[model samples]
Target: MKGLLYLSLIILIATILPLVGCNGSSEEVFKGYQLPPEREEGTTVELVIHETYTDEEHQVFQTIVDMFNEDNPDITVKVERIPKGAQWSRLTQALATKETPDIARVEMEYIATLADRGTILPMELFWAEDHKETLVEGAILSNTYNKRVWGIPDQIYTSALFYNVRLLEESGSDIPDSNWSWEDLMQLARKVSDRNPDVIGLSYGSSLWELSPYMGSYGATIYNSENKRIEIDSPEVVKALNLLYGYQLDVEGWTGSPIQSFINKDAAMVILDSNSIPKIEDSGIRFGVTKLPHGPAGSVSNIDGTSMVIFKDTEHPREAYEFLKFLTSSKIQALWADELGQLPVNKDSFKNVDVNKHPYLEIFMEQVSNVIPKPALPNYSQMEELFNMEMQKVFKGEKRLEHVLMDITSELNGETQKD
Candidate 1:
């Protein structure tokens, strides 16, 4: 498989895409077509961006693109929005066929895979040294692969412990504080459930990288850097998994999609990111956000968000890069956060945005350091699939904790990748 991946990108482009009627349209006709250069006033770059965001979210981004066009008359950025889950698959196919957009907004987890395949342009191609200090370190580290940054973070991403304060109060439980523990959280969960049996006690996330938040609390890591091993079979991990399993067995809690379940009030408390705050707000439930409860190891969480990367075959690399840089500016970042309920990659912007204006965001900003970048593992894609499959078995009470851990660890240890 590794050997097959080494064909020169140029060869792939020449043989795969016929350059005749390849006018960027008709993916079926010009199946691998890209827009030709515009020798006009400004460089016109096509950007493909997708998210689970509402049309309102896309409108905010269009506003940003318009702002960029107004200031830099020499650059034109055309934006296209696609749905999230299918975005990465489509982008990969496009790259393989040499028909790719000039710019793509990618999830940070996919950046390494795309970069390793030489599909995305390197950040050093555009990012200035002075700009380095202006952004958060995690954003840089998240985009780095093979010692070169492959993308620039458009949004600083992190999650908080979101709870329905009114529900907790009604259940006669005190609201959680910054220093709360996992035990405290569980107790609160049980209380809310007992008080309102119709509503669930918790909504645990079963999404990609969802398990990371609980692992560290018990002094466990899915992948332990110190020993250079995947620790799925470790006692700490089993304890963590069982804790969640216990919740499901006890109260009929846990959902495949925590964010939606939370919005529906199917669960009283759940782990959520600031990006989902708008929906929670619109749900008309009195709620608040806090740092996740700590375990013996301390409070730790995962940062899962998207970044913007330029495709290597872009005709307008400079223009696309300029637009990416423009998005990083403090004022523009603040606007992005204001429109989209996310944290700013620029640290200074955090101070400028009044929390009163964007509630629950401050908790996200405060916990940024506690939240680590998804492991820079090249094979994380494969591991995520395996983890989810194994977890489902445990959730259904079909497998014992020790037996499942052993299987997961054995599978992960046998998988190998080249650096």
Candidate 2:
């Protein structure tokens, strides 16, 4: 009887030990890694990014990715590059096929479209509780649609007048100022233009979006917000187009490119987005940046930027959100903006010593505060296409300003009706 009791106790101890070990192992697996706060474990996320950036920019992005991976080993992020111009169409097709990346770098103009299509997940809860003050007001609104915040805005671009300071001084022309009017701008262009049979006074890339600020200065709206009708035929829009066409005709050396123009410095003054600043700085030209010249009504400028968004199909929404939050943090943004010459979306990032020391950085930041976000409409893609086509006709001098305006209004109205 004593031997049987001893044997039974031994068997009970063995069974209990194995069960305890199993419980510990299961807990370890569940507690693998801690992502931000709300993420789950054992999920891998994929990110899609633009292939347009320079090698240096890519290196910066990779460094950020490495930091994220170090902190969250259980959640892996794989990045894929897509061509810049093809990014939107490719993302659209992927979402349709249920292959969307967990996170995507999207254009600010497309935020509304993505939300409308249910491709993006709103991030208001994440941003409002942690990063509300970190971002600039204009940038935050750029990613907001119908009161829903669908993305985190990371970088920004604002239109500025880029002038060859040396050329302007050589031609005995005065530099433009914030108070300069449309007529003042025209005179300055005429003065700086190389009318010697080979030079033009001013050159613009010839897009309606690029020219919209000029139209806005005259109090023109592309769409009647209250009436919900296309208003490209407004008299103000016609006047803006005529002024743009005038530069091509009256300025002796003004020209357009079927291919590339601004990089080659084909014109004296170029109104370009802020992204082109670094390229122009590297060109070894002594350039100066000024506020975009004002028009008859008031001073106006357009905003351009990229937003960081998480797709609705992401397998690791929590992990992806953490990574995005890191990317948009003020500290990281300051480092990236100062080193890369890309404007930071965070207001405090502008206060960094290095960024403030850059000659053009302060001006760009000031402009960021005043610039207007593009129309956040689901039909913007269609509107952009029609606007570009009509503007091309005006640029080629094949259609009068009034005629192009009327045609664009008619076509846009038809599109809106269909929607």
Candidate 3:
């Protein structure tokens, strides 16, 4: 009986050992090497933005985010708006410290520098992979850098000539049409100027961004592309400056106050972007918008507004790309444009919407159709600073127009050479 029991135990051990060592030709070892399944939803993406507008505008942005989240339950977005006047510097610091958010709102002028520094991701890869075609041509070109697309334009604002319709009618001067020349505008301004001692003829913003288009339309390039030189000293630029300065000084009651002065009804006409339309409408003043006064070369206007860009350091690049794509969609763009009083970049949004329905908006949209984007170079901000300082000197009557421009051109050329 003992021998039989021992034999059974040995058989049991042999059976288990063979199963554990199963490298035999009849069976295969179970080596665990497959990846775990992906999560049902994507991670939350963080966005850094600026509180540049009113609380209502911020609420609209929140509404858009809420709608996006409702449609995509698996993904979420968190927006953090930096304090006013500090967004650009703060964002730059974040990039330097490698602490950038997943996405950010950027001005068109700043996009080139951020892209050149590799702080923002190129959207070209996502655009190609998704095969999306909602973006307009002007927007695509504006957000691109060195042949690589960097962002999606969420909004666009272009400058137009806003005049008091009543003032124009009373002055016996007709508002210039799209084909009107600079000389025609000057004459109208002079006529309008003689109307009231308290009303200035025209006003433009103090920033160089607002002044560059007029210079460009005179067939003058601020910076020479090939030689990397500043060319504001050219005869055309001096002539353009002289014209602008003449309006501020020679025209009766012409005060050199900024564009806001015109909105306060202190000036007969003002050069402004679409952003100011809502304010102008709320002021209870009747106004008419027309294409910018033409210069020697032709009519040209500068484009302004914010764009949505994905940071290169974002944890969820694909998700960020998707959100940007949705933001620029025609439907969403039209809704935002209509509500916010911004001109929609989509040409289709204008259909069925009478330009006269919203008197100022109609004019703004019309002006947008003819705009030319400014030079989107990496050094644009630096160039703008120099240009503004020199222009201020000229405006203050402290320096000759030719001397101020030539000095600035030389200084800018020197800076570019060091680059």
Could you say which candidate leads in TM-score?
Answer: 3
Residue 69 CA displacement from its true place in model 2, Å: 4.1
For all candidates in order, the CA lDDT equals: 0.71, 0.66, 0.65
- Model 3 bad stretches (over 4 Å): 1-53, 128-140, 195-198, 223-229, 246-249, 252-254, 352-357, 415-419
TM per prediction: 0.77, 0.77, 0.78
The true-versus-predicted C-alpha distance at residue 373 of model 1, in Å, is 1.9
Alpha-carbon RMSD, candidate 1: 9.1
lDDT of 2 by residue, 1-419 (tens): 11111254334333322211112322332234232344345555445543335578778888877787777776556667777788878887887799877778877877877776666677753454657777877677666555567778866787777777766777778887777887788877776664333434567755766777788777777655456566778988878767767766776333354113455655557777777776786787777888877776677777767788877656566667778888888788888887787788878777772755566776777776765556655656556665675566667776676766665565445432231
Instruction: List candidate 2 segments past 4 Å from native.
Output: 1-54, 69-76, 83-93, 194-197, 224-227, 246-249, 252-254, 257-266, 296-298, 315-319, 415-419
**Cα error, candidate 2, residue 359 (Å):** 2.2
Clashing pairs in 1: 27-31, 42-74
lDDT of 3: 0.65
Candidate 1 stretches with Cα past 4 Å from truth are 1-54, 81-86, 193-199, 218-231, 234-236, 245-252, 257-266, 315-319, 376-379, 415-419
lDDT, candidate 1, 1-419, per-residue tens: 12112144323323322211111221221223344554576335445443344588688888888998889766667777778878978887887899888887777777766765557677775678777778878678777655567788886567778888767777888888778988788888888888889877777865546777787668776655445466777898778777877777888676788888778877778887766787888889888888988887788777767788887777777777778888888898888777666788887788777677787788888877665556544556666665676676667777676776675565455532343
Candidate 2: residue 100 Cα off by (Å): 2.5
Query: How many steric overlaps does candidate 2 have?
Result: 3
True-structure Cα RMSD, model 3:
21.4
How big is the positional error of residue 341 in model 2, measured in Å on the Cα after superposition?
Answer: 0.9
Task: Indicate the TM-score of model 3.
Answer: 0.78
Please give the distance, in angstroms, between residue 270's alpha carbon in candidate 3 and its true position after superposition: 1.6
The RMSD of every model to the true structure, in order and in angstroms, is: 9.1, 19.3, 21.4
